[model samples]
Target chain A: MSTRTELHYAFALAALCALDVAAADAPVAPAHPLDAPAALKAAFAERIGHPVNVLSFGFGEHYAQALVQNAAAPDEFDEYEAVPGRPLEPGRPKKAGEVDCRKKIAFAALDLDAGARALAQARAAAAANGYKTPDNVTLGADVFCNDFGWRAILTSDANDDAMLQIVWAPDGTSPKAQELHDGGWRKVDVAKLLAGSAKVAPAAPKAEPKTVAGDGRKRDFRRGIDADLARLEAEVGAPLGFKHIGIDRTQLSVDVFQSANRKRVSTWLVGDDGAIKLWREDDTIPFDCNKPFAAGDFPLAQLPDLVADAPSRIPPMPQAQVKDVAVYRSGLCGRPHVYIKLEDERGYGNVEYDERGRLVSAQIQ
Target chain B: MAKTAVAKILLALGASLMLAGAVAGAEAPGTDYGWPNLTDFLKQLIAKVGAPVKVYKLAMDRDGKVDLWIQDQAHPDLVDSWEYDHGAIEGPIPVKFDHYPSIAALDHHVIELTTIDFPRLPAMLATARTKLGQPDARVVFIELERGDSSGFISVTDTPIWTIALDSPRHDGRVEFDLQGRVLDVDKD
Candidate 1:
């Protein structure tokens, strides 16, 4: 067996022995899962001195090889390989016919946060197994690379209590390998990617989690939501429409979509005090929903005027209260109209009108 | 005739004294117009009940009445709340209290109203008013609570005072520390 396999074997044996001790103590919280493929691709890109899109990676008993294309200069394909204890180095050029670089890759770009979680878990796992973790390797690193792009071993349970056997199968035949192969790859900045991942990595899971604000109670996440949105709008321009608002105890963020197409335009991270702490423009197509809203059609200031006679016009329910009002386009690439919602004892109703205050549609249910 | 003139002088002095008393009442630290402000209400209640085990929250509604939630000193597990409107105190009513491990471990929410400096409230409100730049801006609500933006959590023992205003932009919530230091001011 190779030295790398022997090292993994020792770790497996140590983890098995430590399992009883771990069980005796309070149960450790589950580690965040890591993205093995993304880390491998990042490490590979760093070694090759170019951002690369990895197509397929194959491992043998002695060595590992990856077929990749330069992300910057398309059509410039290369193959890299590494043996145990050595970093990846260019093995055969794609033009030499020795390496077959396919255009298709199975996975997308990696979520760097997952990578950070992986790193943390790996470090914990190493400490648990009584091994001195290397500084260069990430915590809970699912994939281990040699000095360069020469060799790597991918394992699913590297950080698990009883370390699973490091699968050294050939030609990516394993089910896990196949799944990774089918997932295409994308280019990324390894340093920034790792740093961002590290920032979001949760503190090593404790036997007892630390108490955060709003513990043991259902917190009103929207306590200052309006103030936060207003602050965000003051900083960035008004959003076309809200695509998503993620509110939890630890974090709050709003995904804003702009333009008539309603493509996601930006994201705003909100602080506890309802301030826009950070504003990040949409770097990727996170959402593609075609629902469009004309944010400019009717400002909130116009709602009072538009719904002046709304209660009188909708006679099905008396003493109806205005609940919500929004501007929505009829169809993709259609004109914007105001939709006012009213609620009473029976049910809710919607009253629609154009910007010119012309009644368009009214439905009660 | 000379004795009558002396009597008229005495009457004029008495009227002047009454006017001075009225001016003093108007300028009282927490008196806003003819109504008792939030600080005055809190001071009266705290005097009657003593320092609470913990103060959960306090808020003023549109009617200018104040509602307070405090952990009952007699029963640590229970929360006793009250509503104050127009010089009337209407409760020692039990309220929803969620047991929290953090709060139980450390009584971080306990507040000694007697020790708290409440006189600086007017200045703080004035600062917020100047920042808002709205001539008609008025304090719609005020609260002393844990967690600056969210609901309960043992974030700090130093209680926070949030004053919300009904402004044209609707961005008029101001936060101040117990000592009246401005913590945050939402943009107008």
Candidate 2:
């Protein structure tokens, strides 16, 4: 190619490069801050009759995480402020006092006295609307603000919303307290803001066993023996007879101790099958006399059937009135258990079970 | 050839520098609102209960509210429990008593009673044991109160039952047998 042609090409390329450089250096317009305080104040005035001054503002992330890390840390009020001349540089650190008056916005504030009032109003509003707050309230010192400055956040009884935050900081200019003023304050849907602040209800108390009225005068001495015998027959799938010598009803639990102490035979008639049937020692099934009773030879499933057919009379098992199922746990085997106490005119019994299947033992009260 | 390689390396280096500059320019610092501080609440509860209490469980409900279960050395069965949101007590504070089941199907036997008034610890304990057929079991009482946001007064301790007072008040007590039976329940 000719030198003149090469020169023309180079000039065109140089012009293109210059244009790209200029475009790269051009500045873009900055975005508007959220201006949370102004928006909130306006919202509060509009929603509530009175204009509110935000005593403080809590950035949820900062407050929640900080509390988890150091439940004792002082309240923080430092926030990001857009520097007037240097938009491209890191913003300046504005203290809570400075931010209260800063022009470049998107910040939120918590009202001290006004905040408390607003919270009271909000809680009343919530209660009327069927929303329940937690029962416990916790507050800390206003470290960020001095005596003239109030520093506190009102969480629901459950500490959910941090619903109301109050910061009474020194007027920066005055020593005496001024009539509580509403800075750029905003009204928040406390329930909405505290959506995650529901107190966990305590696990429902266990139900007491129900006592049934029976013949209080004459006691059935054979009831315990009968329970034991029926339990044995059901396990063995046959009848096992034994002479009932005596019964001990004086103790809290009525037990019929049999004469099997002398009999070393593995075929000994275990009087009340209920004990063996419900016994879960190392997942071993009790001996079934119906199937030719043997030590640890019966299937676990048969125990329920045996206990069901037992002639012994037992009181109804107590049922638990569980208001919250989320924390329910069965007392047996440390598993989640739910007991429905069945009661009729005749008597009552406890039907115990869990999310899985039937447990090894169902005691008849 | 050496000159050409050097020129090529310089071009690659220039391109990488431009890319790095562009990436750095796009990054921005984000703001974060920290978590709340609950030390004051715990401390208040310790002071109010007038006993040494340990937090056994801390749970948040579906709505993000927090519930604390604290056990006092005096009353292990009776847990001083409370729930709170931001800085306010959401509801009434009450004492909880534990109960156990008598039947074998129930496991880890425990029953709870809640009352507004403080009751005699011994009476509550005795009633629970007798109902559950566990007379010789140990009993515990838990007391709780709602304080200003500064802190909470959740007192838990074994009642000495050394002093006898004549008054009708609400209180809660829990009874658990050695075998984990929750036999009786009495609550105001």
DockQ by candidate, in order: 0.01, 0.01
lDDT of 1 at A59: 34
Model 2: per-residue Cα lDDT over A1-365, one tens digit each: 99999999999999999877754543311232122323333332332222223333332111210011111222222222221112222112222323322111111233323333333433444354334532211122244333433233334343232244333332211111111114333544335433524322233464543222322344322222334444455554544322111122221121121224323222222212222321111211334111122212222234333334322222232222211111123342254333333333323444444434444344433
Please name the candidate that would achieve the greatest TM-score relative to the true structure: 1
Residue-level error in angstroms, candidate 1, position A189: 43
Kindly list the per-residue Cα lDDT of model 1 for residues A1-365, writing each as its tens digit: 99999999999999987875544432221121132334344445555765666555543324445666667755456766544434444345563122232433322442334333433433444344333342222111123322121112222233222211112112211211111221342222333322333112222343532122222333333232444456556565655365544544334575667543444456666555444454555633543444434334533445455565666667754676665554545444355566667776545667888756678877664
What's the count of clashing pairs in each model shown? 20, 118
Winning candidate number (lDDT): 1
TM-score of the A chain in candidate 1: the value is: 0.32
Candidate 2, superposed: residue stretches over 4 Å from native = A1-237, A240-365, B1-40, B51-53, B57-64, B76-80, B87-188
Q: Candidate 1 lDDT (Cα, whole model)?
A: 0.49
lDDT of 1 at A281: 54
